[model samples]
Target: MSALILFDFDGTLADTAPDLAAAANRQRTRKGLEPMAYEALRPVASQGARGLLRVALGLRPGDPDYEPTRLQFLEDYAAGSTVHSKLFPGIEALLSDIRRRGLSWGIVTNKVTYLTLPIVEYLDLTRESAVLVCGDTTAHSKPHPLPLQHAAREAGFSVERCVYVGDDLRDIQAAHAAGMPAVAAAYGYVGEDDNITTWEAETCAHSSTELWSAIEPLLPSDLR
Candidate 1:
């Protein structure tokens, strides 16, 4: 079977933090709070709504207003899905490299279909990605193995033939659980406290360029 490259949507494959942070800041503004700086909200971008709400409004899942805040955040994010979103630098080259090798790539994200679909379409990735497993696509999300396993299966790869790349610790955890090698995208929304190297990924890439270099050696001889 061909090797499959599965990437996390928000941070690894694409930089969606600017828009996600804006959505969180919008929520803060509605509550009479000041807008948070993009850098301040960036690290939480990988965590989705839960992280954004906490950073901007200090709301947790159990809070009475949390659900309303979350709904609003989703609405705000959708309205500006493409504002500052773009594939990470060097990613285009990396993807082209993968395509030239005749291998396959897909996305497995905690982003729900509502959010994931628009970004995927906006970025024109719909045609190129062989398979997509959104947050809601499976009953469980990462750090559960289900999403990665589901995407790999859809991509016609055994878990052992897959390599999952992401910016979060959960990504590595899930990859290991699914018996796939994990590559950490340290260039992405890594938290201030996160030690990317400690996640025990097969490799840690500090930038898109580094990521490609790190992953290239891992591909089998035929694909390389």
Candidate 2:
């Protein structure tokens, strides 16, 4: 089977922080609170509503307002998900190179299907991706091996022939659990306090420009 490269959607494959930050800011505005700075919110974009809400309003899941707020945040985000979202710089060329090398690529993300589908379609990735596995696609999400494992099966690849790239620590953990090499996207929404080196990925790409070099070494020798 062909070698497969799986990427995490938000932060990794796409710069989705602008829209996500806007959604969180909208929540603050409605409550007479000032919007937080984009820089403050950007780092937590990979965490989705949970992280955004916490930073935006000091709210947590068990709080009474958290559930409703989370739902509204998602609704607001879904409406503007693609307004500023786009492939990271050099990502298009990276994908092209992967395709030219006969490697299959797909997305495995914690984003639920409804949210992910629209953005994928907007970005014109719907037809090109060999597989699209979302948070709801499997029994468990990242940090759990099911989603990555499922993507491998759907794309007709063995775990050994797959490499997963993402911007979150959980992504590396999931890849490890699935027996796949992992590449960390350091240029993505990594938290200010996070140390990329501590993620223990096979390699860390500091920017989209560096991704290919970081990934090349992880590929099977035959594929290289």
Kindly list the per-residue Cα lDDT of model 1 for residues 30-148, writing each as its tens digit: 98988988999999999999999998888999999999899999999999989999999888888877877788899999889988898899888888888999999999999999999
Indicate the TM-score of model 1. Answer: 0.96
lDDT of 2 by residue, 1-224 (tens): 46999999999989999999999999999889999999999999999999999999999999999999999999999999989999999998888888988899999999999999999999888777899999999999999999999999999999999999999999999999999999999999998799988999999999989999999899988867
Overall lDDT per candidate, in order of appearance: 0.89, 0.94
What's the distance in Å from true for residue 42, model 2?
Answer: 0.4
lDDT minimum window of 10 residues, candidate 1: 215-224
lDDT of 2: 0.94
RMSD, candidate 2, Å: 0.8
